[model samples]
Structure formats: structure tokens, C-alpha cells
Target: MTKETKKYNKWIVILSITIPLVVAILFGVKIDAELPVFLPPIYASINALTSIVLIASFWAIKNKKVKLHENLMKTAIIFSVVFLVLYVAYHMTSNSTKFGGEGNLRIVYFIILISHIILSIAVIPFVLITYVRAITNNIELHKKIAKFTFPLWLYVAISGVVVYLMISPYY
Candidate 1:
């Protein structure tokens, strides 16, 4: 990594830990003010958008559209950050909606939800490192990590929407 990219190493570690920790901490914090609008569906939509952008980015790179790929990747990251902000804001303002499905569907919901949560937290560093590699013009390493990062991030994004849909009725 270049000196400039090396600087991001500490930030990547800091953000990888701090983002999830802050989200978990904030999840328990409730404010008395009522939100003007519901946020779950909105954030879920953002997740869906992120997934789409991620897929597009993959396609862009495959088609040799390097600049398009880069731009789309950045857009995906922005969507994820926006989703995180909205998710935290919503959780702080409202109680979580419990999943109400029964039978095998309940099991499926939990399976997806658990995997989604685990991967969402786990994908943070991969994403940061992948982005750093790409932006630093470390193309070979970027491609290597992107192979892993893409799927994890895509699953996290898609599954966030799935979890929301599964529990939306309980809201």
C-alpha cells in the first residue's frame, strides 16, 4: 500500500469496530421524540438500492468499464452509510418489530436474520479494505478482496430488506 493508503489502515480498523459497536449501543437508546415518518421501509429500500448498485458495479468491472465500476462502488458505499444512519435513527426513535411468522418460515426468518447480522458486521473491514485497495490503484489486490467483499456486502444489503419484509407486519 502507498503511504496515503497506509494511513487508512488505522481508520479501517477503527471504523470496522466502531460502526457496529455504535450501532449496537444506539439500538438500546430510545428518545422520547416521535419520528415524523416511519423509517424501516425507507432504510430497507436503501438496502435494496445498495444491492442493485453493487450488482451494477460488478457488471461494470466485468465489462471493462473501470470508471463506471468505481463510481458505482462509491455509490453503493454511500447507500450503505445512509442506510446505517437511517437504521440507527429509526431504532433510536422506535421499538424493534418482532418477527411474527411461525413454523418453518419462522426458522427461515431467524436463519436469514442471524446470518445477515453477522455478515453485516463482518463485512465492514472487507469493504473498507477493498475500497482502499481500489482507490489506491492497487488493482490486483483490489480484485482479490473484491471477490470476497462483493458477495458478503450484497448479502448483507439484500438480507436487510428481507428481514424488514419478514417483520414489517409486526410494526
Candidate 2:
């Protein structure tokens, strides 16, 4: 492996541990009152924005606008970070929302919800690896992994919004 690829090993290690620990801590922590009530809608909009940015970035890259794609990806990452912070903040201050959907839609909801949950966890390392590759000037590996990363990240982002919609009524 090239030095660029080797350099990313640290990031891979850091993210591998950081993400699951963060998830575990956040998941274990519970909140009682709903202070800072604006977090839900804000994070939901961030999720939607992340999805839009990801699609737009794909289009930019397809048109050979590398710089545009870079900017879009950076923006998408920023939005995702903001969404995560807001999500954690909201969760830290409010109770989890209960799903209210019923009947056939419940199945649909659960599928999306489950996939989103799983992908959300899976995408953490993918996102870190993909970005590390790019930043390390390992374009070949970056492109290879980006194809995998994009859809997973996009799905996670889009589903965050869907989950909010499905559960917001109970909140």
C-alpha cells in the first residue's frame, strides 16, 4: 500500500472506535424534559439538506465538475455533523419519540426505519474511510469507496427525515 493509504489507517482506527462509542453512549443516555425543542425540526431539515447535497454532488461529479463536487461533499459533511449534534442535543434533553404508524404502513415504516438504523451505523466508518482516502490523495481508493459510501450516506440522511416524520406525531 502507498503511504497515502497507510496514513488513513489512523483515521480508520479512530473513527471505528469513536463512532460506536458515541452511538453507545448516546443510545444509553436518556432525557426527561423537552428543552431546546427546536432540535427535531432543525435536524430533520439538516438530514433533508444532506440528501439534496449528496445528490447534487453526484450530479456535479458526473458532469466532471470536480471542484463543485468537492464543495458539495464538504457541505454535505458539515450538514451531517450539524444534524448529529442537534440530534444528540435533542436526545439529551427530550424523551425518544414513539412511532404511531399502523397497518400496512407500519411494515414499510419499520423496514425503512430498520435499514436506516443499520446503515446509519455502517456508514460511519465508510464515511470516514472515504473522506480519509480523498484527503490523503489516494484518488483511486477514494473513487472506489465513494461509490459505496454515497448511497449509504444518502440513505441514512434521507431516512433520518423519514424517521422524524413517522415519529414526530408522538413527540
Candidate 3:
């Protein structure tokens, strides 16, 4: 590993550990009595935007627009971080809006939700690793990991929007 990669390794681990723990803690705390009631839609929209950015980044790379691809990917990462912050904040202030759909739809929603949650967690390390590789100029390894990271990240983004849409009515 390059020195640059070593420098980022601590941050990757810190973020990977902190994000889920903070989110979980915040998710259980409700201060709806004090906060405004407008964050869910906003954060959900961020998720949709993140998904779009991810697709655009993919197209950029496929067309050999390396600079555009890099910029878009960085933007997508920022969007993801924004989404997480808003999501955590919203959950901290408001109760979780449970899905009210019954039967097949409920099953489908749960499947999507479960997978999204798992992959969202998994993607953190993948993203950090891929990013570190790229920054360190380890192009081969970056490309290899990014192949897996892209789809997982995209699924997490899209499924976040899906989950929001499904549960919005209850909010």
C-alpha cells in the first residue's frame, strides 16, 4: 500500500465503525415534539440524486471521460454522506414510518429494505477501499473493486428511494 493509502486507512476504519453506531443510536431517539417535519422527503430526494449521479458516473467512465467520472463519483459520495446525515437526523427526531403494505407487497418491500440495509453497510468499506486505491494510483485494484462497489452502491441508493416511497405515506 502506498503512503496515501496508509494515511486514509485510519479514517476508513473510524468512519466505518462510527456511522452505523451513531445511526443506530440516533434512530432510537425521538424529538418529534421539537423538530420540523420535513426531512424525510428531502433525504429521500438526496438518495434519488445519488442514484442518478452514480449512473452518470458510470456513463462517464464508459465513454473515457475520466475527469467527469471522477467528479461525479466524488459528488455521489458527498450525496451519500449528506443522505446519511439527514437520514440520521430525521430518524433521531421522528418515529420510523412503518410500512403499511400487506401480503406480497410487504414481502417485496422487506426484501428490498433488508438488502439495501445490508449492502449500504457493506458499501462503506468497499467505497473507502476503492477510493483509497484510486487516490494512491493503484488503478488496477481500484477498477477491480469498483466493479463490485458500483452495483452495490447503486442498489443502496435506488433502494433507499424505494424504501422512502413505500413508507412515505405513513410519515
- Highest TM-score among the candidates is held by which one? 1
* Each model's lDDT: 0.93, 0.86, 0.89
For model 1, what is the alpha-carbon lDDT of residue 45? 95
RMSDs, each prediction?
Answer: 0.9, 1.8, 1.4
Each prediction's TM-score against the native? 0.97, 0.90, 0.93
lDDT comparison, 2 vs 3, better candidate: 3
lDDT tens string, model 2, 2-100? 776776777788877887679669966877766746788888999999999999999999999989998999999899888877778787777677778
Candidate 3 regions exceeding 4 Å error are none
What is the total number of backbone clashes in candidate 1? 0
**Colliding pairs, model 1:** none
For candidate 1, lDDT tens digit of each residue in 1-171? Answer: 467987999899999999999999999999988988899989999999999999999999999999999899999999999999988999898887788899999999999999999999999999999999987888999999999999999999999999999998888
Q: Candidate 1: list runs displaced more than 4 Å.
A: none
Q: Regarding TM-score, does 1 or 2 come out ahead?
A: 1
> Which residues of candidate 2, in runs, are more than 4 Å off?
31-34
Error of 2 at 112 (Å): 1.2
Best by lDDT: 1
TM-score of 2: 0.90
Writing each residue's lDDT as its tens digit, candidate 3 over 22-78 gives 888878887756555599889889999999999999999999998999999899999
